[model samples]
Target chain A: MNYIFHFGDMWNARGEFVEGALMTLRLSGLAMVASLVIAILGALARTSGPKPLRMLVAAYVEIIRNTPFLVQIFIIFFGLPTVGLRLDANEGALIALILNGSAYTIEIVRAGIENISQGQIEGALALGLHRLQTFRLVVLPQALRIIVPPLGSQFILLMLNSSVCSAISADELTSAALDVQGRTFRAFEAFIVAAAIYFALSLLFSTAFATIERLAFGKRISR
Target chain B: MRSFNAGDVVYLLLAARWTVLLSLIAFAGGGLVGLIIALMRVAQARAARWFAIGFIRVFQGTPLLLQLFLVFFGGDLIGVPLGAWLSVILGLSLNAGAFLGEIWRGSIQAVPNGQIEAARALGLHYGQRMLRVVAPQALRTAIPPTVGFLVNLIKSTSLAAIIGFVELTRAGQQLNNATFRPFLIFGLVASVYFVMCWPLTIAASRLERRLALAYKR
Candidate 1:
């Protein structure tokens, strides 16, 4: 109860904290883009691809969804090196994040795709659009609208989940906070600062996503 | 220099007991606290609602890893030093409570207003109305998401390892370090988690379908 708060110690380590924050942003950004691509493909495959491909995607989603991301990170960071696919800690962390993020994203995107009315696809076909063109022009646009909100939340969750990457020495925000705590012996201050930074980052990302949602879909809605 | 053996698998399984224990503590503690939070979120008092909102925002917005770190380490900075077991349990419970409260709040709200009015017209008080009418309906909607969160909570108990709890993930790390066989060790680790969680996932979906059937015309 008598402990004095030491914001000064954390302030002095601002550079390290900022660098760590950027690393977090970088990791989540890369994972977000990669997962979105993979999710689109996975959703497509699950929805209309050959039977085995759909089953494969289903298995991937189930396994990833059921397991903890901490174990997934360890499996990628430690287990992959044994298979002659060695990657450094950051690379391993990024790949783990992508794999984990994509599974959830695939489910969200698949739900969105399935929610699209069958009539729309039929209409596109009747208009002489090929299957690919129908999917691209008719199905995808409507699906993206349904998918955006959940996708935004998923991306933010990915950003928060990236904290676990520090388990494998990824040098992100949580790791940087630990390093500062180790060096300064100000565990409370170091973590408080890190938590605040994470809070700010989440708010920033959510606001940016809101803006993107508005700009991308604002015109179509009658609100 | 050593290879993974049956003994290592046994060691990992033994350590899994801590994971199960930690998860149960989190779920029980979180359920108790989360019910309070969910009620507070729906409470008529503005202060109670705001308190619930702020609690949910802080807990949900930050990483569980950071929360674990803060509780374990911050305990020492003050006069109270929490052991790893207590800290991990406290941390996960707080985090899980926030999420469960949010989920339950949504379910409670999803219960139709007509039901509430009907209960009021029957001369039921707030507590009676909630316990007898509202909660029963909300329970149906809440089961699937609650189970989903519980599954996530069980998996997240692995984070207890970071604070030196020697749970399942940490046990895997120690074994892998000794055996230097990452594939077998970590793959075994993942399968253990899958075995623990996959059944709950199936149960949640089945419950959702059952609830849907009850409402079908």
Candidate 2:
């Protein structure tokens, strides 16, 4: 306990931390949107597609879920080049995040989708809606209600998982901390600041999601 | 560049034991801490309950990588000098404790309040009420999620590589560097992780279904 706390070096390097936090938000936000799209499609395939397609989606989910994100990113960032897919670090990171996030989100979205009673879809069809329209107009909205809360948790997890992208030299918060700590040798202070930023970022997301839930659910009730 | 040969595969397999060991250490340590956190979370004392909440908030709110970095360096700052093994163990355990604590808290709370009242009416003390009546039911529900979290813990031990611990992931990285076969090496590493984790995932789901049936009774 003899070491005096010196925030001096990390304090001077606050710009790196700020830029890094912004980069993290940017990277995760992009991945969040991209993965949601993928998950929605994958869940559709899982729940309503042909037998072969369902098996394929199920296998993808199982493989991804059972493996580590770090290894998955390593495979994408490092492994793909052998197949002539030479993506830069950020592109690879985004791809990796989307792939990883969708596997989990597909399950979450699938759970939401399956929770809607079949009679509702039938009722929509009975009202002269097309099958596609029935899904979009009737099923999806109700499924979304059950889906939003878990989706929020998944997005928060995706944001935190973005820290792993730094291993591949992706320009995010953890890498930002790595740069400052490597130079300042203030590993303790450097990571503390990075972790606090992450903490704040997650808290912000949680609060925003809670507000969205309130508004969305309230609208349904009032209408 | 060397090819990813049998020796590299053997090396990776050997290194996987460290990953398993690290995971076990974290699980054991985290389990003990999680039990305490779960108890405190459900405790009547405001300070204990708040402490548990804040512990979960801080630990779960941040990424495990940063928490690893903190222990990996916070030790250096405090003159404790916990090197890679000690640091990864402590860091992963703390993070796992927060998650497992939350899971087990839900399980504990799932037990009916009337059951506790019934125990109290029967002149059962707090210890008797918890150990004899509540624990049996909570344990039935807790097993599935607890097993599920172990899969996550197993995958998470790969983070030890960042701290220079030569677990399976680091082994793969080193072999990939030597062989220039990232595809072969990391794929093998991931498959090894899959082999370890997939069975647990299956078991967890099975247990979950069985628990559901038990509750249905």
Candidate 3:
């Protein structure tokens, strides 16, 4: 092998790389919150709403879960404008991430909710608490504990997935690498840098999640 | 631009064959590499265990797309010169290896200690014990998740499009470019994927449920 390594060019592109990483973080963070909200509602409806609503949530989860995110990106970014709705690439990427993330999170949150026994909800009701109050007070805390570990991993997957947004030319770490690689023709060094940043970010997030899991839910075993 | 037509649908379906072919190659390669990594993760030697752990960490911690990018371009830069086909196969296999290794390791560990101890007491070697006893049991647990990962693998092959592999999604992209029917083309691409994946998803769940029932019995 006669390939000479040139990471010097990569080092020179640090600003763009940092900006891209921050873009990834921003894209993922916003998607996480938005999807969590949607998942919570979706899960609630799936668990206890009308049959049609439950079926709608079920279909949503199944369809989104089955399709590739890349296709979803094309549909949103390119297809929507054809239907008289238009969103810029970043907006479309964010929406796609939110939609995709919610399907899985809805399932996760639903499973967590299901883990709460019927008796507890009954007990909360028998205590004369309102239904919403019963949910917020009696159900949510325990459900959150059950859901955190999976939610953490799912969020990380979502973050990793936002890398796909680069396909639509949204400003993210992977795209930053692509831009530099295009300019410098240093594909290997550029991708390695991006991949390393991703690795570090993943480790950082997983470690943080593990700590949160331990501190917040380790001692309490809800019966 | 030519209008979207049945011929385009046929073209898209034909391209799906590459997606399936790539997935199968990765599945086979991943299974082989994964088996070795799983064994290493469960091995008695510290170095073997650590190597397996590090392999899993690197592969799993990074996005699969970046792995594909690295292998696709990194190979050329390093002078190995793997083209898109071989690079995607190698990259997906390695990534799948890490995930499947982790899955199978859990399955291997879940084997009762008494079973392994008895195999040892019977004077069976590591290969004999793992092959004859541990693997049979582990295979049972591994099958559902293995199938589950295959669905993930199939969906992931779409990322090969970004690297310019003309699989199902890439074909959809090409059709969309020509026909300007992103909704029809990409939606059709998604449906093709959904059809390919949903059955496996169902089968995986069914297998999981069956396994759970077996445990109860």
Reported per model, the fraction of native interface contacts reproduced equals 0.85, 0.94, 0.87
Candidate 2 lDDT for residue B204: 100
For A120-207, candidate 1 gives per-residue lDDT tens digits of: 8999899999999998899888888889977888988999999999999998999999999899999988988999999988888878
Order the candidate numbers by TM-score, best to worst: 3, 2, 1
What candidate 1 gets wrong by more than 4 Å, as runs, is A219-223
TM-score of each: 0.96, 0.97, 0.97
**Which candidate comes out best when scored by DockQ?**
2
Model 1 earns a TM-score of 0.96
Model 1 per-residue lDDT at A14: 98
| C-alpha lDDT values of all predictions | 0.91, 0.92, 0.93
Question: Candidates' DockQ values?
Answer: 0.81, 0.90, 0.85
CAPRI quality band, candidate 1: high
TM-score for the second chain in candidate 1?
0.96
Give one digit per residue, the lDDT tens place, for model 2 in A43-135.
999999999999999999999999999999999999898899989998999999999999999999999899888989888898999998998
- Please give the distance, in angstroms, between residue A187's alpha carbon in candidate 1 and its true position after superposition: 0.3
Model 1 interface DockQ: 0.81
Residue B82 in model 3: shift from native, Å? 0.9
